[model samples]
Target: MDAAVNTPVVVDSNDDGTVTQELELEKMGSTLEEAIVETCSMPLENRPRLPRITLSKRNRAVVKALSRMLIIFLEASRDLCETDLILFGTAMAVCRIIGAKFSTAGRTTAQSSAIPAWGIIIEERIATKMDGGGR
Candidate 1:
C-alpha cells in the first residue's frame, strides 16, 4: 500500500485565528481482521497448537507481558504484514518455551520436552508462512 495515498487530513486553529491543514502520514496496509482471517486459514499443519495446560502464576505473568508488548507493537505500527504475524507467533512461542521450562523443572526430561516441542512446531509454522511466498 502507498502510505502517501492514505494520508489523513487534520485541521487545526492557530492562535492568530487562522486554520491550518496538515496531512498525517500513516502506513497503509491490511486490517487486523484481514490478518486474522489469513492466519486462521493457514493449513492445520502450518499452525501453532499449544497444549492445554493450566496457567501458573508465572505463566500468567509471561502471557500478560507478551500481550502488552504485542498490543504496543501493533498500535505503534501502521502496516500489518506477514512478518508481523510471524513476530507475534514467535513471541507466543517464547511464552510457551518459558512456561514449559518452568512447569517441567521438576518433571522428567521427556515430559518437560513437550512445551519446547510445541514451540518448535510453532516456529516451523511461522517459517513456512514466511517462505510460502504468499500474503
Candidate 2:
C-alpha cells in the first residue's frame, strides 16, 4: 500500500527479565485489520521479548544485504514489465515480514498468500502498542 511502514509489539518482561510471545495468525485471506485485532486481543504476558542479540548491531547490514538482493533480482529480470518488478518487490517484502513475525531466533520466510498490506498494518499496530502510541 504505502512506501514505508513500521509495526512493533512489546512483551512485558518476566521476573527474570525475559519476554515470551505467542503470536496467533489467521488464514492468509483474512484482512490485515482482523489479524491486528487478533494479535492485540491476546494477553500481554504472551508477548515476551527474546534476549537481545549482540550481533543485532549488524541488523542494518543485514537489511542492506537483502535490499541489494532485491535490486539484483530486479536487474536480472529486466525483461519482465514494471508491474512484474513491483510485484516481485512486494513479494520479497511480504516474505521479510512473515519472517519477522514467526521468527524466534532467526529469520524465516512467509508464505506468499499473506498480503503485504496486512503485514504493514500488523507492523504498525505492533509499533503503536509497543511504543504506547496507539490511538
Candidate 3:
C-alpha cells in the first residue's frame, strides 16, 4: 500500500468549521428539497420532453414526507451499504431532476387507501437495478 493511502487526511473541511460529512450530506438533502420544489413549480411547456409527472396536492405532501423518512432511515440506520446510499442519492437527484406537482392542485383525495409509499417505490427500483435491469 502507498504511504499516501495510509495517511490520514481531511477530505472535506473549511474555515467555517462546519465541514463534516454529515453536515455536507444534510446540505445535499436541503438542496434536493429545493430542487424538487423548483421542478414541481415549473410550467409544463418549460419542462423536458420526457414524462412530466404530477400528483395531487395531498399526495405531493405524503410523497415528500415518505421520502424524508427514507432519508432519515438512510442516515440514522447503519443497515445500508455505501453503494445503497449512492443509489438513493442518485435516485433522488434524478427525480428532483424528477419532480412532481399537480398541474392543478386537487380538491379531492388522490386515492382512498394508503399503500406503496415512495420509499417502497424506490426500494423496488433499486432492487430491479441491482437484480440486473428488468421489471
Number of the top-ranking candidate, with TM-score as the measure = 1
Local distance difference test values of all predictions, in order: 0.41, 0.37, 0.41
What's the residue-level lDDT of 64 in candidate 2?
34
Off by over 4 Å in 1: 1-45, 76-91, 99-135
> What is every candidate's alpha-carbon RMSD to the true fold?
20.2, 20.5, 20.1
Looking at candidate 1, the ten consecutive residues that score lowest on lDDT are: 22-31
* TM-score between candidate 2 and the true structure: 0.22
In terms of lDDT, model 3 sits at 0.41
Q: Candidate 2: which pairs clash?
A: 7-123, 7-124, 7-127, 8-126, 8-127, 11-47, 19-48, 19-49, 20-48
- Whichever of 1 and 3 has more TM-score, that candidate is 1
Q: Note the residue pairs that clash in candidate 1.
A: none
- Counted clashes in each candidate structure: 0, 9, 1
Runs off by more than 4 Å, candidate 2: 1-56, 79-99, 102-135
Give a tens-digit lDDT track for model 3, residues 1-135: 011111111233333322234543454455444544444555534443233445544324333433653554446545545434433333334344224322233233345334458867887889998999875
Between prediction 2 and prediction 3, the one with superior TM-score is 3
